[model samples]
Target: MTTSKKHGSNTALVHSDYQAPEGFAAFPVGIHHASTVLFKNVAAMRERSWQNKSAYTYGLHGTPTSFTLEARLAEIEQGEHCLLVPSGLAAITLVDMAFLQSGDDVLIPDNAYNPNRELGDWLARSFGISARYYDPMIGAGISDLIRDNTRLIWAEAPGSVTMEVPDIPAICDAAHAKGVLVALDNTWSAGVAFPAFDYGVDIIMQALTKYQSGGSDVLMGAVITRDQTLNARLQAAHMRLGFGVGMDDAYLVLRNLPTLKLRFDAHDASARKVAAWLQTRPEISKVLHPALAECPGHEIWKRDFTGAGGLFSVLFDARYTEEQTDRFVDALQLFKIGFSWGGAHSLCVPYRIKQMRQHWSHDGILVRFNIGLEDAEDLINDITQALESLDA
Candidate 1:
């Protein structure tokens, strides 16, 4: 009489009675894989809102895994709200689509990350939005470029390969004065070296592909904002774009978060050492490390940044041709030739700066370095040998 109704083998398999103990704990966040979430009752389902992240409505909105990562990233970046995207470029596009509309004008730095610049051009070409490029060094002078329809300004602290650090606070001040929002590609700093919001950046975009993952494996990005209203706009765009990050990737980033600052400092120490040595080299015309006096906006960098990441660029001696630089890059043993940085393996990339920028005043071949976790002396020896290839 008292026994529960027996179910068939198939039904038993589909709906298991077993449940794991509730008190178990672990260091890593549980990887929650779910496309559809169940509710205790119909009333609970009716009350659920995807926008209110306190509860989950669907997998696309987020699971505990993604939400945990988002909260940690927001805390690191000093933002109140955060949204994860598929990639760093996706984060830029999300910001653009969220804020700018038809007849809106946006200002972009000439030396911005190539993908970002390309996205701006595409928006201008297809959408009714107007995207204009401005000098990265314009600073407060940016005020003159703002139009009545200008809605957003994109700033990169140090221009990508060319590495010209801009006056961010001044730019933010100018943009805010015009009631325009400033979005910063803070990927270079990895939220470890720089506090973006403290300096007045309204929106902070990070390429988690770099230091956050630190494994050269995951591709992810985050958009963070302190203003709830602004975050609401971003949430709408995020939903419309169907942006969903893998819970597995989310866990990967979470696993690496504890060592972020430590790794960043190690990279900083090695990079500065390598950059300083390069400055004394006969083959290098200029080292574009922000810590060095030769870099543009070095003073601003000193005033604003607490530290620098492993990334920096070097301009070869004008005497060395592109062929020679290519030879040198090809000969490197420890440093792999590739794009994107922040892994344990050193990387070198050569950029055609003049072609990428509207007004690139630099004269030599621009080569960027991402100093890895290797010993600086060993890396220097590798570079020393590679430099000999320039002669052949």
Candidate 2:
């Protein structure tokens, strides 16, 4: 700033027009949080539109923090647009609300996340929408179930607890033939291990609460898309729902994105190790992991996914009582019994197989594990000690 001798004391501080100097460079983008954004004038306000995304309109529409995250996520997912939502479940809800209407049918894999099925059920019975469950391995056979009114098809690569990997490309091919859009609850891959857009998925949602944050401290979800028209549908529903993510949470996810690959590799390697060891145990009748040869859709997984995440499920022999299963799960010290993955602590959650799936049948109790960043040997030791409790 050039100073004038005549305008002396405090003039530079108060009256100088040298505000917002140029040429400053920083690594992280500034967090532009605001409910009210001031415009240069009324003309600029009228010209600023939220549809183009060239600029921000309000905090609900978009902010620098969110815009950066969205652009980066879209880039990573091989998509053209991205929408950030409050929670992973909310992201699922947003897609469900946007696509399906009364008298429309939505096809979901029988092994989808339980809550997603529940939400679909509510959206079905309460409203006029209908949902049908199909085998995860249905593949192009999905054509059998796709009716004239089918609007959306939902798939989860490796079925949540069952760990059945679907033939996604084939399924997408069938979905598209019928003019239906395919959506995936891709939390297992974090939209990293699998390329959603490349594989023919129309829209994919990620529960950033699990993997993206790289820490369980934040809760967020993302809806990434390649088609502008489909993205517009999601954008409209998102706005009407008034879904606004916290700037702090968005920044937290942005900070963690760089470390996602490293953490995911650690989680994948550790999970494979633990799953392999568990397969050797006598009490485990079966190990449900996508990478393993015994998993239902291992071949499909091998064909599609680049790598598997830290989550997998195992079945205790039918000889073990429900109480015994609980005893074993409760015995673990290092593997905490809880839901959710991609955190520092390993977790376990037992599921009643019969209640969860309609097309598949299993004789044993199912226990899912989220392998965390702990040493593989330590995690194995924890599992070995816990299995001893089955005898108790």
Candidate 3:
């Protein structure tokens, strides 16, 4: 006989013919923060190998918290599997380490994040692997750079500080034709503005420390892949490296995921407003924002990306000296001078293009601006005042 319990007009089923075993009920979030998981018996422990997702043997392999975070991230990127790493750069390294072998070559965009480019150089020197730089605007022409030993191709849409949007689909198609895997540093778009997987990328790497945390306090990265085999390889590499993150940081990123869309939209609107204003300024020579119609690769940006983010750079008119550029950055009252953006507060950083590029030409000094959630008018006023200070 089955009996049902009712409370407050809601009925609950209590079947006498059925029984729920111990720990059968599901926890709401499954916040299992543990280094070692206990098993019911020796047989269960031996059967619980680290190969499968449900079986957890060690914390570095995964805890319930990390697993939950991975699942949520995979959903966010529309990936089949996801692996979390210590930092965004670590995610990049994991992908490289997972695929490339000694004497193999990896193609990197010339305008890629500096740290990533540096890592490639280091990997070449240390691991006997080779790294080559290709123009960010290579498109289908990237086929020219492919060698028999080329194993991986790295893509960064709207290339780092210069913001040159690439023909991602064309590049991906070309890379895949050669049986080379493509990995994108999707930090700028935060997976919300651009769907990396939809464009035929095998792996999507994001710095959760940036938009995902939204607070700038945590440093976290995620490698998301739709290919199960690639995911397993990345996971195995991650395990060999002893990659693990704090449970609190995972919880913080999870908490912020709900508001990612809202924050991203706000950032996009503010950045577009600011970039538009800078385009008309006398002191500004060029604004390297892909969303701006005048910016290079604007057409490709329009074709590929859904929206933009708050990070953009402005090249000062050739008339302004480096000291003048420094003064302008120092004159800003609201914008903080710092490195690494995607935080709640506005930031400004000066750049020297001669140091950042190998083949690109620079007309003047450049300053990267990270627009925050402040009022657009107020932010504009701050910039106007800074430009005025440049004149003074």
Which clashing pairs does model 3 show?
Answer: none
In the range 1-392, model 3's lDDT, one tens digit per residue, is 45544333333432243465676664346466888787889999989877688878987778878888899988988888999999999999999989988999999999999999999999899999999999898899999899999999999987778888989999999999999989999999988888889998989999998888999899999999998899889978998888889888898888888888899889889999999989998888899999987777899889878889889998999999999999999999999998777778999999887797888787989899999889989999999888887878
Q: Report the alpha-carbon TM-score of model 1 versus the true structure.
A: 0.98
Candidate 1 segments exceeding 4 Å error? 1-5
Which 10 successive residues of model 1 have the least lDDT summed? Answer: 1-10
TM-scores for all candidates: the values are 0.98, 0.94, 0.92
Best by lDDT: 1
Better of 1 and 3 by TM-score: 1
lDDT of 2 by residue, 1-392 (tens): 66566676777556764568689888776777889877889999999987779977888988888999999988878899999999989999999989988999999899999989898889888988998888888899999999999999999988878999999999999999989999998889887899977889999999989888978899899999999999999999999899989888899989889989889999999999999999999999999999999999999889889889799999999899889999999999998887889997899999887887886667888999999999999999999999999997
**Deviation from native of the Cα of residue 148 in model 2, angstroms:** 1.0
Q: What residue runs in model 3 are displaced by over 4 Å at the alpha carbon?
A: 1-30
TM-score for candidate 3, residues paired by index:
0.92
Model 1 lDDT tens row, 9-90: 7786677666676999989999999898999999999999989998999999999999999999999998999999999999
Q: Note each model's CA RMSD in angstroms.
A: 1.8, 3.5, 7.0
